[model samples]
Target: MGSPDPNGRQLDGLGGGISSLSKICVVGPPTRPGVDVEFTFVQVGVKNSDIDYSGNCGNLSSAVGPFAVDSGIFRPLKDSGDVSVRIFNTNTGKVIESTFPVCDGEAVAQGDFAIDGVAGTASKVKLDFMNPGGSKTGGMLPTGNVVDCMDGIRATCVDVGNPSVFVSAEELGIDGTILPDETQNMPRLLERLESIRQKATMMMGMADSPEEVPASIPKICFVSQRNSHMLLSGERLEADSVDVVVRAISVGQPHKALPITTSLSLAVAAKIPGSIVHQHARSGVENKEELVIGHPSGKLVVGAKLDDNGEVERATVYRTARRLMDGIAYWK
Candidate 1:
């Protein structure tokens, strides 16, 4: 991916000039036992040269299994039917079990299952994040508290799929349904959120000072109770269809959709009493394992299973991926 381009278009490389589009995944044979493949996720910067490997990408993880099967990194026992791939992410030291359909020794790319953000329907790829707690920091509650006061606002810092800080959008004096373009125009709101995020980063021990914080880790989002809102697609999302509403910031820009890791952390936070997310989420969500989160693009349903100790045992999310291309390029 291109970097250090002031224009930010990344015309010299494969980057799409967006953080989500500027990513790379290196897959290889597993070094550890009981793992089918080991992959490293690289977050390349579009406008800057900062290559961050601080956290895992939930969206990209969905594509690894199919890639493994098609690339022959992990061969399926059956030529046709369902298969599972155990993947170890080097960035987070977590295992993700990817299960999908295969036909004639190739991963199937056509199906009826659909997900938000991406257009059209395709084969469903089920990803079960095993023991996703403490992905980056050392504990689920990295700050040792369910809620911490950051920048004079109450926030819940969680580290399930990734370290995340959640606050109530109502307390921030902003509508929860603000679109990404609208968020870009509010400099002060962005500054305040960055301040809170930096503070949370320090409190979570991800960095010693504000300047040392990586741009990609420690995601921050604001939450609100389920309410009717318009999605980025201009479709109405009813209140009864979702359990909570969230607006997340990624790499200092408003995200078009919720990150999978952030969704995992939010699902975990929703189960914790007294958390800012729990307080703002729809009532009676604690007893339920699945949490439907409404974002700018659409709603995502994530499931979090808690063990006997009430800690997150696993987190589940479904996604769809298809091979865009397969080739090699020269970069200098």
Candidate 2:
């Protein structure tokens, strides 16, 4: 991928000039026992030379299994059926189990499963993050408190799939359903959120100072009670369809859709009493039921299971993936 392009567009390389599109996943043979493959998630800056390996990308995690199979790094036992690939993420030191259909030793690429941001339908990749808590920090509550006061507002800092900060949308004086472009117009709000994020990063022991904070880790998001809203696609999102509303910022930019890692954090936060997310989330959520999260793109259903000791056992989410192309390119 291209970098150091001050113009923001990676015209000389494969980067799409955005944080979500400018990601790289490196997969290979596992170095640990009981794991089929090992991978590293890299977040490359479009206009800078920053190569961040501090956190895992939940969306890209879906493709690592299929890539391993297609690239001959991992082989399935069956010829045409569902196959499971155990992956170890070096960035988060976590294991993600990827299960999907494979036909004749090749991962299936076509199906009817669909996701919010992507168009049409494709094969469903089930990603199960085992023992997901404390992805970056040493504990679920890095601050040693359910809620922390930062920037004169209450926030919940959780470290499930990744370290994340959740604040009330009303406290930010903004609509929870605000679109990405509209958020881009609010410089002051963005600045305030960044300040809180920097403080949270230090509190989570991820960085020593504001300048030392990585661009990707400790994602900050706003939460609100379920309410009818309009999505980026101009379609109506009914309040009853979702349990909570969220707007996330990634790499200092408003995300058009909620990051899968952030979604996992939210699911865990909602279960913690006195947290900002728990306060605003819908009440009477069943223990075994999946959580429906409303975002700028649409809704996503995520499941989080907690053990008897109140520790996160695992988090599950489904996504679709397809290999766009396969080839080699020369870079100057």
Q: Which stretches of candidate 2 lie over 4 Å from their true place?
A: 286-288
How far off is model 2, as Cα RMSD?
Answer: 0.9
lDDT per residue (tens digit) for residues 88-160 in model 1: 9999999999999999999999999988778999999999999999998979999999989988899999999
- Return the TM-score for candidate 2, rounded to 2 decimals: 0.98
RMSD of 1: 0.9
Candidate 1 local Cα displacement, residue 161, angstroms: 0.9
TM-scores of all candidate predictions against the true structure = 0.98, 0.98
Clashing pairs in 1: none
